[model samples]
Target: MDVRRIGVVGLGAMGAGIAQVAIEAGFDVVGREVSDELGTAATERIGHFLTRKVEKGRLAQDARDAALGRLRTTTDVSELVDCDLVVEAIVEELQAKRALFVELERFCRRDTVLATNTSALSVTEIAAATASPERVVGMHFFNPAPLMPLVEVVRGELSSDDAVATALDVVDRLGKVAVPCHDTPGFVVNRVLIPLLNDCVRVLDEARVSPEALDAAMTNGAGWPMGPCTLLDLVGIDVHVHASEALYEKLRETRMAPPPRLVAMRNAGLLGRKSGRGFHGY
Candidate 1:
C-alpha cells in the first residue's frame, strides 16, 4: 500500500518524534493527543526540533516550514480515519493499546495498516483485539525516533506478509534501516540491550564501581557512544524496569529480570531524566 497519509497517536516524546519524522519524510501526518493542550505542546515541540535542525544547517528553513505545513494535530481519534497507516505510540500497557487498536479497526478501512510502536508488548496480543489481525503489525522505533536510524518491523504470528511489506516500505521512505523480527518481547534491540542495562544495574547495586567509572569503561573501553547508566537515564528508568519485567515474565530468565534497585528507583518516582533522577541524576 502507498502510505501517503500517516496517523500517530499519543503525542508524547516518542510520538512527537515519530510524527516529526513522518512529516520530514514527505508524508501528511495527523498527530493525536488526548487533549487540546497536549496537542499544542506536541506541535510546539516538533517546531522547536525542526528549528534546531535548521540552525544546525541540517535542514533548510523553507524545508522545515514545508514539513510543518504538512503536519496537523488533533485531539479526536476520528481525525485518523483517513490516514493510510496509523501507528499507536500510546501508553505501554497492553489493555490500553488493545483498546485503541480495537477502536481504530472500527473506523479504519479493512486494508488500513495498523501498527503499534510498543517495545516489549506482544504484537500478536494487540492484533488479536482488532477485527483484522492480519493488518496489524509492530513498528518499533528507537527512542528519539527522528534521529534513530533503526526501525524494527515486527511481524506477529497473524500479521500478513503484505502488512509487513508495507511497513518496511514506509520505513524505507522515512530513510531508516528496517530489520524484520518476530513478535517477541523487546523485539531485537531491547531484547539484548535491556539485559545489558540490567547487568549494569546489578554491578552498581553490588557497589563494584561508580556510575561514572562503569560508564567510562563502556564508552572508552568498549567504544560505545554512551554507557549503560547514561542510556538508562535517557531511556527512562521506569521504562527500563517495565521492559525488563515484561521480558522476565515471558522468558523466565534471571538476566531478563529487573534488579531490585531499579524497581526501588521507579517506586520512589526517580524515573531518570524525565523525572530528574534514576541511576544517576539528570
Candidate 2:
C-alpha cells in the first residue's frame, strides 16, 4: 500500500510525539484531538518540541519548517477519512479504545489500517469493535516515540497478514525497528516490564530502600541505563500505574498489582517531568 497520510487519534504526549515523528519522516500527518482547543494544544506541543530541537542544533530550521508544513490538526474524526492509517493513542481504558475503534471504522476506508498504541491491553479485544477486525492491529510504540527504536507490530487473533505487513512497512519507513508479536496481554515488553516496575514500587514501600540507592543499584549493579525510580518518573508514574493495573486485571499476577505509593503519587498529580514531580523530583 502507498502509505503517505497518517492520522493520529488523541493528542496526549505519546500521540503528539508519534505525529511529530511521522511528519519528520515525511508523511502527511493529521492529528485529531477531542476539541479544537486540544488540537491547538497538540500543535503547540509538537511545535515546541521541534523548536527545542532546532535550538539545540539537533534539527535544521528548514527541515523543521517543512515537517510542520505537513502536519494538520483536526477536531473531527471524519477529517481522517483519507488517512492511509490511523493510530489510536488515547486513554488506557478498554471501553474508550473500543468506542473509538467503532467510531473510526465508521468513517475510514475498510482497508485503512487501524492501530492501537496500548501498552498492555489486548489488541484482539480492541479490534473486536470494528467490523473489519482484520485491519485492526497493534502498533505499540514505546514512550518518547521519537527516541524509542522498537515498535511492537502486534498481530491480533483476527488481524490479517496484510495489515501486520503494512504496520511493519510503516515502522520501517519511520526508521524504527519492528518486532512482530502475537496479540496477548502486554504483548512482550510490557508483560515483563510492568511486573518489574510494580515490584520496584513494592521494594520501595516494603523494603524502605531510598529511591537514590535503589536507582544506583539498578544503574550500576543491574547495568540498566536508568534505574526503576528514574525510569518510572521519566515514563510517568500514572502510566506505570495504568500498565500495572491493566496487566494485573488481565493476567491476575500479584507482581503486576499497582503499588499503593504509585496510586497515591498519581492521585496527587506528580506525573514525572511533565508534572514537575514523580518518584523523584523532576
Candidate 3:
C-alpha cells in the first residue's frame, strides 16, 4: 500500500513525537487534537523539539524546515479521511477508543489502515469495533516516539498478515526497530518492565533502604540507565497502575499485582513527573 499521508489523532507527547517522526520521514502529516488550544500547544512543543535537534546539529536546517512544512494541524477529524494510515493516540479508554474507531470507520477509505497506540488495551477488542477488523492493528510506539528505537507491531486475533507487514514497513521507514508480537496482555515491553518496577515498590515498602539507595543499587549494579523508581516517576504512577492492573487482571498472576506503595502514591496524588511528585520528588 502507498502510504504518502499519515494522520495522528492525538497531540500528546507521544502523538506529537510520532507526527514529527512521520514528517521527518517525508510523509505529509496531519496531527489532530480535540481542541484548538491543545493543538497549538502540541504544535509549539513539536517546533521546540525540532528546533533543539537543529541546534544540536542533529537535523539540518533545510531538512527541518521541509519536515515542518509537511505537517498540518487540525481540530477536525474529517481531515484524516485522505490519510493512508491513521494512528489513534487518544486517551487509554476502551469505550472511547471503540467509539472513535466506529467514527473513523465512517470517514476512512476502504484501504486505509487504522491503528491504535494503546499500550495495554486488548487490541483484538479494539479491532472488533471496526467493520474491517483485519485492517486494525496495534502500532505501539514507545513514549517519546521520535527518540525511541523500538516499535511493537502487534497482531490481534483478527489482524491480517498484510496489515502486520505494512506496519513493520512503516516502522522501518520511521527508523525504528520493529518487534512483532501476538496481542497478549501488556504485549512484550510492558509485560517485562512493569512487574520489575512493582518489585522495586515492594522493596521500598519493606523500608529496609531509602529510594535513593535502591535507585543507586539498580543503576550501579544492574547497569540500568535509570532505576525502577526513577523510571516509574518518569512514566507516572497512574500509568504504571493502569498497565499493572490491566496485566494482572488479564494474566491472573500474583507477580503482576501492583504493590500497595503504588496505590499509596496514587492516593497521595503523586502521579509522577506530570504532577511533580512520586517515589522521588521531581
- Model 2 is weakest, by summed lDDT over 10 consecutive residues, at 199-208
Candidates' lDDT values, in order? 0.93, 0.92, 0.90
**Model 1 spans > 4 angstroms off:** none
Ranked by lDDT, top first: 1, 2, 3
Most accurate candidate by lDDT: 1
Give the residue spans of candidate 2 off by over 4 A. Answer: none
Arrange candidates by TM-score, highest first: which order? 1, 3, 2
**Model 1: per-residue Cα lDDT over 155-233, one tens digit each:** 9999999999999999999999999999988899988898988888888858788888999989999999999888988
Write down the TM-score of every candidate. 0.97, 0.96, 0.97
Instruction: Compute the lDDT for candidate 3.
Output: 0.90
TM-score: model 1 vs. ground truth: 0.97
- Name the better of 1 and 2 by lDDT: 1
Q: Model 2: what TM-score?
A: 0.96
Model 2 gets an lDDT of: 0.92
- Candidate 1 residue pairs in backbone clash: none
